[model samples]
Target chain A: MLLEVSAEKRFGNFLLDAEFALDCKRCGIFGPSGSGKSTLVHMLAGLLKPDRGKISIAGTPVFDAARGINIPPEKRRVGLVFQHSHLFPNMSVQANLYYGWRRTRKSDRKIGPGALTTALNLDHLLKRDVNSLSGGERRRVAVGRTLLACPRLILLDEPLTGLDAELKSQIMPYLKKVFTEFDVPMLFISHSLQEMRLMTDEVLIPENGCCRKRMSTEELARSSMTSVPRSYVNLLTLRRPQAHNDIWIYSWGDEKLRLIEPGEPGDNLFELGASDITLFKRHPEATSARNILPCKVVEIFGSGGRVGVELEGGGGRLVSQIVHESVRELDIQNGSELFAVIKASAFRKIC
Target chain B: MLLSPQDMQAVWLSIKVATTATLVTAPFGFGIAYFFSFARMPGKYLLECLVNLPLVLPPVVVGYLLLLFFGQSGFAGPLLKFFDLRIIFTLTGAVIASAVVGFPLLVRAIRIGMDNIDIHYIQAARTLGAGRLDTLLTIILPLSGRAILAGMTLMFARSLGEFGATIILAGNIPGVTQTIPLAIYDYANTPDGDRMAMSLCLVSIALSFAVLLASEALARSFRKGSADAP
Candidate 1:
């Protein structure tokens, strides 16, 4: 395992009690606001000490309250990319990136300044002061700085928050590039499902200051989190796109789904909630919905009197919520062919 | 009018003592400020209060305390004499007196600057593998530049104007330990010494104003540099 953390802390009324072990090179912690996601990661990074428990990174015990061992953050060799870029305002971009790089032991250095500067496209930015960089640029610099530190694991605490869609997109690719090019492990934290889906394959979900569940990102993308059983949001990766005034047609196998939102040129994927889809045993005719896909039922799961039907149609997969009575009446089962209908407004871009 | 030789000597002596005191105390002040800014030691508040005691204590009481510690009959006197060094009633004594009176102002200004720095920056530095001292040298010191300048200015001005402590310890020995304040005190007490006293008072005010202006300029540049940085 790359990391294992079992710790408990209390902050006034909030209690952060979480325990999880991660082996994946790129894992994510997904939760809503105040879910103790940040607190958990901060503990992992050794920025915040656990009141009582243990944290081990790469099999090295960074914190063991029972043994009275709490390694300092600098000695932990775990890098942190804060939600707000904490680039040294007094230093140039180059200096900030090298601040940790220079301090890292010669033998311990894996990623060098030259490699990071190139991967992050920090050539022109090297001489610029950090305050002058745009939000996207600052985030990129923060990533580069962390990477150059040669950390065993990198913890990103909602790094994409406080950014507009355009800037987020601009910085997202660089993050992906850095993660791919560098060999360091990364634990991403975010409240946005779309961001988690984009960045991680394994996810740890936090609830009320505790890690409640650990699941694959793909599984998380399919599950409906809301209590409203009538609707369950299902996410999909957008394939080839063809724009048609106010409507963007996305290819799904031999079928095409029309999205009502204005499509940006380079949008990669989109989300469609299960509640937005209606299942028909036979193809419907003359409906106001812009999308009708012939599909087969893959699985049926029940939750609180409602049945969630997973379907595969054309080239994509979707989940739909149907009444339990309908499931018994239609005799839905695995491989039961059906048609799924989606309205024009049902699809939203994921950036 | 041109000052008499004795008064000019006093002005020069004050300048030398105050400048030396400020320069000597600044680094120590920054170190204490940095410690107070971050460390979580027990009795940290007590340490802070002790460091700040001079700012509240009467100047004569501080001088008396210093005399008890460093005077010929005090505990440190033998240790000092072992090195053939004498501090009492010398220019060094005058510098020490001014510094003790102004130490709190220096540390307070520096602490304010250190407090203004975002904790996240220090945290970031640590996670990036920079140790505490490394972070302080590269991050805290550079970022707290403005505060340090302000503290130094205040300390310098206070040292220049230091009276009660200097009189008590340095004994107003003209051309030896007597600074501008002591000289002014002497002139104010002597009959027909009014003109000289007034002239020295104006000189002191002008000197303090110049120091304040220079320090302000330095602080503004630091602010501007950070604001205009990327």
Candidate 2:
């Protein structure tokens, strides 16, 4: 395994106990706020010592509480891109990126600055002071700096939390490129399912303070509703439109779906949260919903008093959750034909 | 040409003593300040109080304490004799007395600078495989330049005017240990020495103004450098 951790820590009322082992080149830890996601990453990076248990990276035991072996953070060879992009205020962009480059051994250097600068589109930014860069620019530099360190593994903490839509779109492509080009394992932490899908194939979902499950992105898309809010349901593939600048148009069978924003690279799936969608027994006129797809009910699943009606329409599939009373009133059943009503803003694009 | 050869020697001695004291106190001050800023240990408050004792104590008492430690019959007598180094009533003693009096000011400035540094920078440095020393030399030291410079200047200024401590430990020696302040006191006590004292006073004012101006310029440049960073 490239990374192995079974650690427990307690902070007042909150307890963090996470255990996972992964050899995948790209893996993600997905959870909501206060899920102990950051705490888990910190432990793996050796910033915080686990009260008990062991953590190993690339076959080297970096921390073994029982054996009294704990390696310091500097020697752990795990790089982290902080949420705030903590670039050194005193150095230029070139200096900040090279700060780690100069420290790594020549034999360990898998990539050089010249190529990285070109790939990250950082040629014009190297000589500028870190303070002058925009939010998106700073994030790019932070990633470059961490990657140049020649670490065996990398950890990125919520890299897209605060960026505007424009900045997020600008930086996401570069980040995806880095994820694929780097030959080391990476542990990405995020609350956004779209970001997780874009970056990793496998994911560990943390709830409360423990990693409750580990699964692939495909499984997560198909069965993500267990831990997520009721609004989010199945993930469906969407074909990119030929030439749409602001809105992405995906045509299913004969139904056309229009999304507000562009999707990340390799993004073929769109999340239709059940709450954002409604079902109609007959085609209604004068509705604000931009997407009205004719679908056939394929399956019916229920939880509590809510009913999840899976529909296959326009060469795509999705689920719509409605109250049991509505299902009874509308007589929703398997093989029943219905129209799935989706707001243009409700479609969340994911890779 | 308003000053005599003896007056010139006094001015020169003051500069030498202040410069030496500032240089000597800098490394110790930085280390102590860095420790106080970052390290967590038992009785840290007590250690901080001990380091800052010179700031609140009387200068004469500080000199007396130095004398007791470095005197011929004091606790450090053996060590001093082993090195064949004389500190009591010598130029070196004056330098020591000035450094002792100015130590706290230096540390306070440095500690404030160190305190303002974000822990994230240090964490980032470590994750990038930069060790403690490496981070200190590259990140902390460069970023804390203004504070270090301010501390050194404050120490130098304090050392220039150190009088009570110098009188007790180094004594009033004309061409050796007598700095500007000690020389001024001597001239004030002697008859027909008012003119020389006035000239020295003007010279002292001019020197202090130059130091302050230089410090201001340095601080401004640091600000500009950060503002223009790209």
Model 1 ranges with Cα > 4 A deviation: A10-15, A32-34, A66-69, A112-122, A221-230, A243-247, A253-255, A260-267, A304-306, A325-329, B224-230
Model 2: residues >4 Å from true position, as ranges?
A: A12-14, A23-26, A31-33, A197-208, A211-230, A233-299, A302-306, A312-316, A325-351, B224-230
Error of 1 at A102 (Å): 2.2
- Across A86-148, the per-residue lDDT of candidate 2 in tens digits comes to 998888999999988998999989988888888899999999978989998999999999999
Point out the worst 10-residue segment of candidate 1 chain B by lDDT: B221-230
Q: Is the docking of candidate 2 incorrect, acceptable, medium or high quality?
A: medium
Query: How many angstroms is residue A325 displaced in model 1 relative to the true structure, after the best TM-score fit?
Result: 4.5
lDDT of 2 by residue, B171-227 (tens): 999999989999999999999999989999999999999999999999887773333
DockQ of each: 0.65, 0.59
Interface RMSD of each: 2.5, 3.3
The model with the greatest TM-score is: 1
By summed lDDT, the worst window of 10 consecutive residues in model 2 chain A runs over: A224-233
Candidate 1 lDDT over residue span B1-230, tens digit each: 55899989999999999999999999999999988988889999999999999999999999888888888889899999999887888889899999999999999999998898888898999898888888888888888898899899999999999988888878889999988888988988999999999999899988988998898888787884445232
Residue B8, model 2: lDDT of 92
